[model samples]
Target: MILLDEAARHLKASLKDMDTVVLTPRLSQVYAGINGHADLLVHKLDDSTLAVAAECTDFFKNLGLHYNVMPIEGIASPYPGHVQLNIAVFGKWVIHNMKVTPEPVRAFYERQGYHFIHVAQGYTKCNLVVGRRSLITSDVGIYRTLKDIAPILLVESEHVALKGFNYGFLGGASGLINDTLVFAGSLERHPSYARIVKFLDRQGESWTQLQGPLVDVGTLIQI
Candidate 1:
């Protein structure tokens, strides 16, 4: 009732485990069936972490990650309990050097089962951390919230929308190397974005049919 009303009210909630279980029944079944298909040991990486001597997700990818890395995961939304914190980096702190972030951030990730390990860089590195051998995530925006980082502002590269999580971060790029941890969202909601719709009428990975596209679960998520 609430979800239907929200949709009718023009407000979609940020997805959660509850949403996953409720909405994507097939995906849940798929995950359950593939749960024993070799655990995917993964990692998250970025330039700031590289400069700071912290290992990036590329390191894990080159080592052959247990699973494929999807760079963008969640959608970007305002950080909680703030009026204008999400875009603050653009106006004022884009180039400023900061010694520390709000304490709530560290606490937030810690609550998400992430073990904080500070990287020591000759006093010129941003604070960052990695996952604890489980769900690999470093997006501070959606660390505990449903909001992923904005995808439009990411570095130029071809990106794919993974089937499971949208509003989250993945570590590596498609070819050059592992993608950096960045906020990625609004891939499907964009008019210019087109992905490989592999399904019934949508024959190949890349095709366009004005009539009607595949409406299966996978196609629904990507196209």
Candidate 2:
């Protein structure tokens, strides 16, 4: 089920827990660095990511984690589904754009215990992992809606990178492992890095900055 062994190696090394991992094919030719963006390409009711998920599922299952693949289709036409599965899940909340999320995936989330909340913007990539009870985002709508129930920080999006787009998102450049939050780029360059760090520190959470620009690689999923 492995498409590129070298890329898988890099992915394994980037993860804090390597006992079992699910690797996806990369979209970027520069596979040496952490290119998680290339790996996640989910859509609504499509089989676009099925093959990769199947392979990764097998890979993880062999490691005794009882992993299974649920390949989701990416969006169609002009826009790319680079962050299709980028919805944020914590406790009973599933924060995302209900209009774009795949029905199967949403149903799966419900079966596993999650409630959906619709937001106008589909840029769920700007999320910063702060456990289920808290989250960090640049989208004003989300911040306003979830702020009362969950601890949240609204950071400006001018500093993030999206390559083809205007800017990258916070969630796309972030990943959660155990209690550590890893960012694709250094927070030092972010205008609100200090405030962002302070927010996490107060929650007893620590962050690790990965070497590279703040590219939106989509959410690094653990399954």
Tell me the TM-score of model 2. 0.71
Off by over 4 Å in 2: 1-23, 26-65, 80-83, 127-133
Q: What TM-score, over all chains together, does every model reach? A: 0.18, 0.71
* Cα distance off (Å), candidate 1, residue 99: 5.8
Clashes of each: 18, 10
Question: lDDT tens string, model 2, 35-99?
Answer: 33423443222212232222234433354533344655443223334445546666677777787
What overall lDDT goes with each candidate model?
0.20, 0.57
**TM-score between model 1 and native:** 0.18
Q: Look at candidate 1 and tell me the lDDT of residue 72.
A: 22
Task: For residues 1-223, write the lDDT of model 1, one tens digit per residue.
Answer: 0111111111113222112211211111123221111111111222211111012235324533243443222211222111111111111112111223234433433464544322222111111111111111133332232123211111112232333434211221110101111112333342323431112113212222211111111111100
